[model samples]
Target: MAPGGPELLLIVGIAVLLFGAQKIPALARSIGESAGQFKKGQAQVEQELEEIKPDASGAGSAGAGTDAETDLES
Candidate 1:
């Protein structure tokens, strides 16, 4: 289902042909930054979901607003 080594190499070769070797590093860096931003957003959403759910004792959601404010302030 996933690409093997040769397929990966072929993909890289195509990328090189399209973008050229000199631009590859910049493209990779941009992709890396985008991926990082995506991950951070995903983590924030998960944390918010956790805050919204009641605890084991069913005490109800707590501190969700304050946490948002903290994130905004930082």
Candidate 2:
């Protein structure tokens, strides 16, 4: 469920009281920066996963050389 107007206002008021007016802007800025970094990291991980997905699906079809190689090594 989502918060209503009153609940949001109450939370904002509490934050203001806890952090003070002067610090609020700085806190907001830091929170925004952190969110941006989190999103960037999430995108990077998704891209890497996409890059590996095709290779993973084709691995089995690449043939039995892998097994033969392992046997030779032993």
Best-matching candidate per lDDT: 2
Candidate 1 to truth, TM: 0.70
**Backbone clashes under 3 angstroms, per model:** 0, 0
Per-residue CA lDDT of model 2 for 1-74, tens digit only, reads 98899999999999999999999999999999999999999999999999999899787756677888889999
The C-alpha TM-scores of every prediction are 0.70, 0.77
In the range 1-74, model 1's lDDT, one tens digit per residue, is 99999999999999999999999999999999999999999999999888766564354234666678889999
| C-alpha lDDT of residue 34 in model 1 | 100
lDDT of 1 at 8: 97
Which residue runs of candidate 2 sit more than 4 Å off their true CA positions? 61-74
Each candidate: what lDDT?
0.89, 0.93
